[model samples]
Target: MTTTKFLTDEHLSGRVFDGGWTTVASVSDVTEPATGKAIGKVGMTDAAGIAGAAAAARKAQKGWAAAKPDDRAAVFPKAVAAGYEYWDEIVEWIMRESGSVRAKAEFELTLSLKAIQIAGAMPYEAQGLVLPSETGRTSLAKRRPLGVVGVIAPFNFPLYLAMRAVAPALAVGNAVVLKPDPRTTICGGFVIARLFELAGLPAGVLHVLAGRGDAGEALCSDDNIAMIQFTGSTNAGRMVGQNASKHLKKVSLELGGKNSLIILDDADMELALKNAAWGVYLHQGQICMSAGRVLVHKSIIEEFSARLAEKAKALPVGDPMSGTVALGPLINQQQLDHAKSVIEQSVAQGATLLAGGTTDGLFLAPTVLRDVTPAMSAYNEEVFGPVAVLVPFETDDEAVQLANDTEYGLSAAVVSKDVARAIALGERLNCGLLHINDQTVNDDVVNPFGGVGASGNGTSIGGPANWDLFTEWQWMTIKGTPPAYPF
Candidate 1:
């Protein structure tokens, strides 16, 4: 077991605090995914506990919303400073609890910190707009915070994904009740709790409920929660959307993606290979925007596949905590098994396994497959692992068809030496995020990140988009005394 300052005995013993750390009757063991060993135990909040947290959040939200926007914004700078102060600890927890490599862990921390910094400015952004009015009355459209928000975050990129919503919601004066994935309770839940505590956020303003599906369901259905912000698999997202809809609550879902990296014949092979490898293998491909499909022009498919295979074979895979490795373990046995199954099924359907198809414990080697067709599972499904399936296309139309065929429309990229051509080609793909001469895996605090179709409900959240996602609009009109009434 590893010792920690953030996740202490009080936090682990299921004791509820006034800070929204509600009591838990039971606990679940937190395991180090790389070693499959119990590192600590986290309190498990059931449905009732979720309701308690939501009530607390609703109560706290009153004062939080009433405070001056600058005052609310003041807390975030302190939070950002605390994040820097505990940088090493945050990175360690992310790597340990989430089985992320050091690089990925560091990247997540950077993004998480950036999110807080960006959110600090959100309170000052224009919350309303003046509109053209008739009958000499001043008409104004204004935004108001949705009383309390429920954040259901995923295990992959846990901290950043959680904070991206949590920070912005709080900055805009809405209290947050976060339900982190049970697998990453510490990094996704408790860490944020500790940071805000250090930053002097008022009690009950931000609740951390480390829990399972029942808790999540409670969060969505709880009347006190006005909205739900979710990031996870598409299937789970559907359930969240359904539950939230039943209560007439707002929902912002950032779901699954089977993203593609399209390499045209005019692409620079060296750059394309780097983008392809990084896009598909970073964080072991646990990212929602990881490139699941590598579409190459038939003219360059042979060369691209051969080099990609070489790159995969050379990349290091091991326990991230033990050393500096390019890849880390799949989150658990199920992910490993799923990746293996995908590889086997794709091969059985005539996709050629070019490089890797082996595993040691939960660490699956970076795998590459060639000649993948739409008929194969690798092409149709979102393989959330370090496996890249290469498909050949003869024309630009075919490439667009291949990229847009998937139900997922989260992200897609085009790689070509001809930047103009790449942009034109990229514009044809049916995805929310499209990159030209770049990789599929990318995110920034300023960008409105989201997707369409199965990927999301056509809503985005980040930067200015946060205002819309976290608040509701109202139109108000002013008159000197009273307008002449029509009888």
Candidate 2:
């Protein structure tokens, strides 16, 4: 609404973003995040675009993969240099094109810059392993590139979500083709492509296909694509799974999560509010790993509930570009409506609204819900917007049970001053990334990421542990004289 130079269907550059001028940018008509109306028109990448890109990748991936791991690692610094040069400019565009608030966009850009740096020096992290003393078996197997990697990124955390694959996929010696979510294609993929290109990297090693859903479908199902990396809703994740399964291709999914937070009685009342609020309301609760359902210790439930309501009421809500804004607009109207309907439906089913359940002009107010039970649909779902449900628990055992009740086990947090209780509760919580005395979103660059079940498949995305997501171990055999196993 502010900057009238709309994006292009063909992703030309930051200056020339004219995506079909279709008002609603879409390859196959992308549904607006706010209105659910097709707000923009995008060009369709036919089968040939997929084929051509795949063909280009087939040629480049071999050479890229054959290069030493250290050589591949060098690309990161070059990328970082290019990225840092345009950090502020890109941050502004991330706000404009992706609708990210200034601070969140800066957070994303900064995190991505750090991720690139970490990856630059990660050739050591991608190490080969050897096994000995297994009866005539002295094996050393190294990670091999999955040839062409197809990355389908979601729009919510555009930079973070998209690069989650790019850094590792490239680090493990794979060529990549990134298909960005239609709504924020310009801010996400095109920007990355521009940066990588500016870094003086070889072309075709990484390509940006800027079309819509049809392009993604074509890319995911391509025979030439060795592996697929996806991050989005479970329904879309399921479709990607089905397509990959049809080809028996390897796929890594960071899908839907219904993360839960536990606030034990021993936790500092002040700390719990800050951490829970960060986990639930930050990014408008648009993160897949958002801690939407919280189980508070009954002893402190009354006090915790009051503080949470006040916090939600206090979070500044408005245009993301506005510096004073705490909560930005839900990616679009559809999300706002969906989030609103869930809270409304819960209220209809006897759930108590503690604070802030309102939406206007793409802004969904930070909401707090009490008297929530597992029976309500909102209790077990990924709201993908700012809505927190408070469910009080009688004991630690009951708290653990309540937290683990959901089908999703992506991430969870245990808040308590007792170190033993935090660790004990964290172990029993049953999720990918468990935080003790902290919010689920807190992490170091070296920690292993990902969740169990529908949260995510595989390990995680930081520090020394993140490389496992891009590799598979193979047991190599050597014959002394016709090797045979002794049972």
Candidate 3:
């Protein structure tokens, strides 16, 4: 493997992009989750810096929107090419900072590429619509860019999710003030700026800010920001929405989930086991759509639980740099503690800890819990770790009930031999994305991806859905003939 200075150098860390690459006085370390070693450090931008970014973006947006749509679209493809060019560096940063295994790191980068490509295609695909109106006029609705967008992204899947918002907003001719999680600034924010700059994106079009919650709060409330696109926990998302509402700025939030997976009695055993393992343990289960709850029909619950325990037990946990490791550590010490606390609390509440409940540093063992009741904390809460809770249901009605019982309605999966029945069940579950005979951790660039209830508010974030959030619709009429007087 060739050497790269991106993560290895101390002074190179915490790079900021307001209009150009620089660093700040206030800095924080970016530590590897598997080992609490400081792999890199990031310079934290103050509220004043965030305000400057928003102002810069507002200044850039007018010029960008006035440019030909094709010209705006041209930048994304170049950015996508740059992302691929630095794939190794990005993957290493993802693994080190986010604790994602090799496959998961690759998947994150793949999604980043897809998001950029999809954004690149948005210019030609998304446009205004003509409307039939009263006589003597041709009426049409045109989509106009909403100036500066404040994008606040989470640490888990940082690069991919940040691009999910950033790429789309820029593609639709809006400038962005992106504040990625401080834990993941190197790849998520700093590298992203470099990618766009290398793609020849104009100065101030995309400003990358790296900071903590204070910085995020500042971005949401900044007057220069026209809109806010956020992806994080439910509590944090609520704050973002409220702040944006105060300013009357548009906000799109993709929040937390206690996503569930249901396996019917007649489900193909092989498929059920496969989906169960994937839904709960992929990326060490640090995903919004990770299957926190698995509702199984009582008849097959025992056998299914045994197989799942084996699957969880067999997962190898180690350094993300190890090519063979399937499970890496949680994002940080807080996440590890939270997962452990939830697991222990659930056990106290009578949920059986069937397999794997301990931790080695940030690396928690892939855990499985049985006899998990709705009232249990683990069943109700979003355990953002490699933990799966099994709840047995006697009937399909009960399964549906269990799935919809959470405050979160983000994503769900239903598995059954009867396709029609599975569809029916999926319909009853409250979530934005539903997959039959599959896991909950599924997304496509073309689909509208957002949740209901506590999951999000305002708009979805993918393909054409993003155009709605980043642009405003204005109706225009051309008078072909003289207007008729009322008198």
Candidate 4:
């Protein structure tokens, strides 16, 4: 592991890096979600203050975009190295603020560093095209960076989600104004600013702001911000889209999911059971791609339900820092209450609580529910907790139909030993990502990640897709000599 110079607790506050870490605004105290202890505080700026940050970013963007691509690429090595150096510090903040276990926190940090490295290389990877033209003329098309981009990231997977947009935006020569969920400001907003600074990024290139909905609205509505990239709930995404539409700004959204994990009759039972637990219980199921629904072949429903229940019971749940705990707390008390209410309502609607449905403070037990129907609340809604519902399906056609029945199309998985059959069934599932013979919760630095329907407008992120999302194409045509009179 890489190491940074020792940092005191005082250095982690939401200090602005307009030039150096300086307190520019009042801060809000951040509490650990699991223990409800005051862990730290983050700077909170009002609408006007956020706009000031955006203005600063807009100004810096001009020069950054004008710089040579190699110069821009040079920044990533330092940024990536800094990421390694600060890995432990940031992971502690991630665990405390986002309620992530050590494993999930490490995964977020690893991916965040890889995201920066990948984005840095994108400047050179962009290729312009020469096109055929009329005689004595040439036609060419090139991609240019968009102007300042506003990023609004969610609390869950705070570091990875925010950097997912910020790294790419900066790599493509655009400035960024990032607004992290206030609940996760320390890890999501404050530390991110420090990381870029350690990478030797110039002032005004990246700005981090912490606030509630009002501040997010301000960032999106700013005329100077050319585009907005958002990752959050579906309802919040709708508001983001509407606000951006008012100015017709470019937008990319990765919203919510009610993803399904389907088990075919030929699936390896042991693998299926293990993946099922990993898919739904990781990070306490706060992930957007978490397997909300598990559709099992009716012939194996009883056996799968029993085994999954035992698995859920066996997984450790406690404080995230324990290192041995597999499940951590929800992000806050509101989420805990919501999880409980959803389970209760589902039970009232005829779903059976199979293994766990209990909560101790903000920490909920790994829950598995069986006999869930299409009409139940848990079946149709995203619980956003460590709750997985089992619904039986007799045929592949039925499984596919049931999976596509919801408005969400973010992710789906099909587990089966037969490759051809699983591939065929995967084709029929309506989601942005499919994990054949695996589970629904999966992500990579390379893969087009996004969704359709209410989940999002089908914009993609990752790999070359980000280049396409973050830049605009321009066509140029020139005559070799003066043209003759038109026919």
Question: Tens digits of per-residue lDDT for model 1 on 1-487?
Answer: 2244655677766543448555567888989999988877878888988888899789989999999987899999999898888888889999999999999999999999999999998888888999998877899999999999999999999999999999999998899998888899889888899889989999999988877788888999999999999999999999999999999999999999999899999988899999999999999999999999999999988989999999999999998999989999899899889889999999999999999999999999999999998899999988899999999999989999899998899999998888888888888888999998889998988899999999999989897789889999999999887866897
CA lDDT of each candidate?
A: 0.90, 0.75, 0.87, 0.87
Question: For candidate 4, what is the TM-score?
Answer: 0.97
118: Cα error in model 2, Å = 1.8
Q: What is the number of backbone collisions in each predicted candidate, taken in the order shown?
A: 0, 26, 2, 0
Ranking by TM-score: 1, 4, 3, 2
Per-residue alpha-carbon lDDT of model 3 for 224-277, expressed as tens digits?
998999999999999999988898999899999999999999999888999999
Worst 10 residues of 3 by lDDT: 2-11
Where in model 3 is the C-alpha error above 4 Å?
1-11, 480-487
Model 4 lDDT, residue 168, Cα: 89
Sequence-dependent TM-score of model 3:
0.96
lDDT tens string, model 4, 120-195?
A: 8977884578898887788999878888999999999999999988998898889999888989877887777877
Stretch of 10 with least lDDT, candidate 4: 2-11
> What is the lDDT for 281 in model 3?
93
The parts of candidate 2 lying over 4 Å away from their true place are 1-44, 68-71, 124-126, 133-139, 472-487
